[model samples]
Target: MSTQQPAGGRFQTFSAFYPYYVHEHSNRTCRRIHVVGTALVIVIFITALVTRNGWWLLGMPLVGYGFAWVGHFFFEKNRPATFKYPLWSLMGDWRLFFETVSGRRRF
Candidate 1:
């Protein structure tokens, strides 16, 4: 498959990009790490809101991306689609997390 675009020249919509996103996260460990990171990000966001301290917000990306990057580098041994498709990749992360939690997808 070509990495230049999502199945074609470009992904016209998130639905179009989703399959590619899932494909990039084929590694089970990578998917689990992403799920964990996303959950932590959600918790941090809530903490930031509850404490009314914006500083906690700063760690959101760090926590999320840190786990994800480690999974990609060490487990998946592949580059994250985030570099090429930031918005879609972020959306995919949440979608995958929910799917896993709902038992629609394996963790």
Candidate 2:
């Protein structure tokens, strides 16, 4: 089933999209991958701060997305929300990452 929003419309709000986000990350490996990706993003952010190189900020999405997509392709075996909802997918990525790290998420 296509989760695509209808033309000239926005997708569901983050709250509504949350359950689907959790469903997409149901696999433990996927969850862990997201965690690592999120950590890498933080590292990149720190590097950017220390070096004062704004370009390093670009690496955040690269680290976050590259690792997450690898997990989806090899383990979750599903399409990434990036293909459908780029911003929300990124938000969901970080949200899920924190949830996993904080032990608030059930695998």
Candidate 3:
């Protein structure tokens, strides 16, 4: 899916980027992997805080991005939006995660 840009040729707001983000995750497996990756990231974060394990903190990106990359490369068959829109992409991931878990969106 193409990113619909405004006159500036960029998404000026997250609301704009979100639709493109959703389009990018059209593959069911990709969305599922993203949800799982985000969940694991949250769990890892809590573990790191509870156990004072800085090493676990370091594993967050590895686990999260690894699963996401697998989904993207093998399933989604497209480059991740993260490479271009890092902050918004992360926000999209968490939003999609909560939406899926809360029944607002499908798994």
Candidate 4:
């Protein structure tokens, strides 16, 4: 896969970036917050579509990143990987969300 690295890092693959992603979220609360934020983002997306309230779409990034940044700042005590690896970090979030929920990885 290819990416547009706005933060100018060397991660070439999602497979390669995932380990770092996992490490950044080592805190339990951070991971839990991420799960909740991801779920809420999904709900927000569906709500936007169902309700046809474009305003709800505005909350997607706010709710998603707000919770994520809170986890990073308070629990992880680190910067979010999203700042550097936007696409991969997003991929990581969904992958993590699914993995945690589907029993492939522990919550």
lDDT: which candidate is best?
3
* Model 4 Cα lDDT, one tens digit per residue, 6-106: 26557767887888788889999999999999999999999999999999999999999999999999999999999988988999999999999999978
Candidate 2 lDDT over 1-107, as tens digits, reads 33444468656588767677777877889888888888999999999999999999998888888999998999999998789888898889878877877889854
- Using all chains and alpha carbons, the TM-scores for the candidates as numbered come to 0.90, 0.84, 0.91, 0.89
Q: What is the C-alpha lDDT of each candidate?
A: 0.90, 0.83, 0.91, 0.89
Best by TM-score: 3
TM-score, structure 4 vs. true: 0.89
Between candidates 2 and 4, which one is better according to TM-score?
A: 4
User: Of the pair 2 and 3, which is ahead by lDDT?
Assistant: 3
Tell me the tens digit of each residue's lDDT in model 3 across 1-107. 35554565678789999999999899999999999999999999999999998999999999999999999999999999899899999999989999999999999
Worst 10 residues of 2 by lDDT: 1-10
Off by over 4 Å in 4: 1-9
Name model 2 segments beyond 4 Å from true: 1-10
Could you tell which candidate, 1 or 4, scores higher by TM-score?
Answer: 1
Model 1 TM-score relative to the real fold: 0.90
